[model samples]
Target: MERAQPLPSYLVHRYQGWKATGYADNQSWYRRLAELGQHPRAMVISCCDSRVHVTSIFGADQGEFFIHRNIANLVPPFAPDGDYHGTSAAIEYAVTALKVAHLIVLGHSSCGGVKGFHERCLGRAPELAEKTSFVGRWIDLLKPGYERLGGNDADIDSATLEKEAVKVSLENLLTFPFVQEAVDQDKLTLHGVWNDIGEGGLEYYDAKSKAFRPV
Candidate 1:
């Protein structure tokens, strides 16, 4: 194990500013949250991209959304074979332990991971084709979506594939028996969302319409 280095000067200054402002203003709120423990109503699985701010998007307060971020905002089909699975572990905790009522799979436009996967499947980006590549392997979970959408050549463009990544994650969430049971019991609801980072617009999946509509 290695001791992490001290924070950079800029980050230290930013932390100080937050402590002096946001933290100071909400000191009691923070203390109460620490005492109560987080019981967020929804669990949001979002991309690791910097531009997608879940709190800012929904104007959420602390303890309002339990957020788990990963590459491409993906959720692989449940596999409980004793393998190390960070995303699945988080999902299990959020559903079974936290009992979150809503689970959201949020994808975004201009996602580098999705673009890389799309390019890789098209016989480009040879680096991503390697099994040892972490990004490649993680985004591979979204392949079922591409296959269902017609395999990278189905007249659909790259952006639609990004949205389909959201759809894939939603479908995969159901593969977990706990998640499925919760949904069946009406204790949990699943949602798929695609955000246009540049446009600052959100599109939500509609099961009945089988399409994404802007909100």
Candidate 2:
């Protein structure tokens, strides 16, 4: 095993600053959180985009939300195969162990993952179509959503497909038996949300309207 080196100077400076301010101000609260463990009320599955700050957007405090970030905030159909499924593992832990009351699939506009999937479907990104591309396979989970957008349409915009991706994930969540049980027993509620990063606007899926409404 390789020995880890010290953090970069900038990261060290930032850590020191946070320790002195954010950490010092909430010493007692932090201690209480450590002692009691976490009881977050919700789990947020979102994109790995740096611009999407999950905690800041919701004004969440420490131990308030269990979050999992991936290429496109996608959830695959329940596959019990004995393989490494990071996203599925997180979902199982959150639904069964954490028993979170709410599960949110948050997608954002201008998502690179969604765009890549779109391009690949249109035969523009042959690289992503390769079997060895990790990201290609990951975003392939969004194939269903892309098809919903009329896959062959050359003019399909990124924004439209981004929202559809959210709904696709929400649908896939139902494939997980535990998640289905929770919903059936009224113990858990599922939500699909899209964020307009540039405008700082939020939209939620309305089942009745089958459309995204501003929140």
Candidate 3:
């Protein structure tokens, strides 16, 4: 392993503040979580954007939500192709091992990854096509999502595709047998959420209405 570095000065200061405040106030709760282990009821898959705060949005306590963040908040089609699937592993552990009651796919506006995927797929960004581009390959997962939504138009607005990313992930999450089985047994529920960062508004996908309504 590479040599490990100490925490940055700012991070250390923040840690000390939290230890004196949040952690100190929740010592028993923290000890309980440590002793009993985490039994979060929901697993949230959200974009790795610094602006999207899942816990704060839901007013969730520290151990209440198990969160997995990735580029564009994507969940690939269940392809047990024996590749290094970090997202898949997290989902598997959350659903089968943790037995989470809910799986939430959260999307957001102004996502850099989504923008990258949109521009890259539509041929607007040629630099992302280079072989060494990691973002290009990661964003490539959004291709199947766009195709499912029948959005091949290079001129289509990226914001629309960003919402479709949540839809595609919700669809793809069912491809996992464990998730499907859990839902079939009514042991688990699936949710899709979109966050409008600029407006401070949240829209929830209503399967019956087939639309996102403000929550």
Candidate 4:
């Protein structure tokens, strides 16, 4: 087996700097968190995009939110076939074990995953349409969102599809019996949001109006 390489010099230096500053300043708080374990109020499912800074967006401190990031912030409908499911595993843990009060699906503008899905649907990205491509299969979960846009790639808008993908994820979340039960009993709430990366603006889905509103 190949040995794992050490972190890059730049990352190592940054880690040292953080340990001396951020960690030093909040050593006690860190210790308390270690002792108490996490008791986060919400679980955020967001994109793996580097620019989408989850903690910075909410001014969240360590251990405040149980966050899961994937290619397009998608959640597949419940399928318990004993197969490997990373995202579903995270959701199950958050809902059943952590008992998070809220589950939020956060989408962002200019998401590469969303763009790739759009291109794939339009047959512009043949690589993503291949069955063996992991990313292709992952983004295929967004097919429902694509279909919602009339399934006519020629007339589609990527921006609107991004928000629709968020809504689709929220819908898929309820497919889990645990999540459905929690929502039905008022034990957990689900939220969908889209962030405009360029403008630093956030809009949340309003179920009542069936639209996204500025937050």
Global lDDT of each candidate: 0.94, 0.94, 0.89, 0.94
Over all chains combined, what TM-score does candidate 2 have? 0.97
TM-score between candidate 3 and the true structure: 0.93
lDDT tens digits by residue: candidate 4, 1-215: 47889899999999999999999999999999999999999999999999999999999989989999999999999999999999999999999999999999999999999899988877899999998999999999998878877886348776789999999999999999999999999999999999999999999999999999999
CA lDDT, candidate 4, residue 25: 98
Q: TM-score of each candidate?
A: 0.97, 0.97, 0.93, 0.97
| Model 3 C-alpha lDDT per residue in residues 1-215, reported as the tens digit of each score | 47988989999999999999999998999999999999999999999999999999999997899899999999988999988998999999999999999999999999999898777767799999888997788778787767766665545666678888888899989999989999999999999999999999999899998788899
User: Residues 75-150, candidate 2, lDDT per residue (tens digit)?
Assistant: 9999999999999999999999999999999999989999888888888999999999999999988887777777
**lDDT score of model 2?**
0.94
* Candidate 3 Cα errors over 4 Å, as ranges: 1-3, 148-155
When 2 and 3 are scored with TM-score, the better candidate is 2
What stretches of model 4 exceed 4 Å from their correct place?
A: none
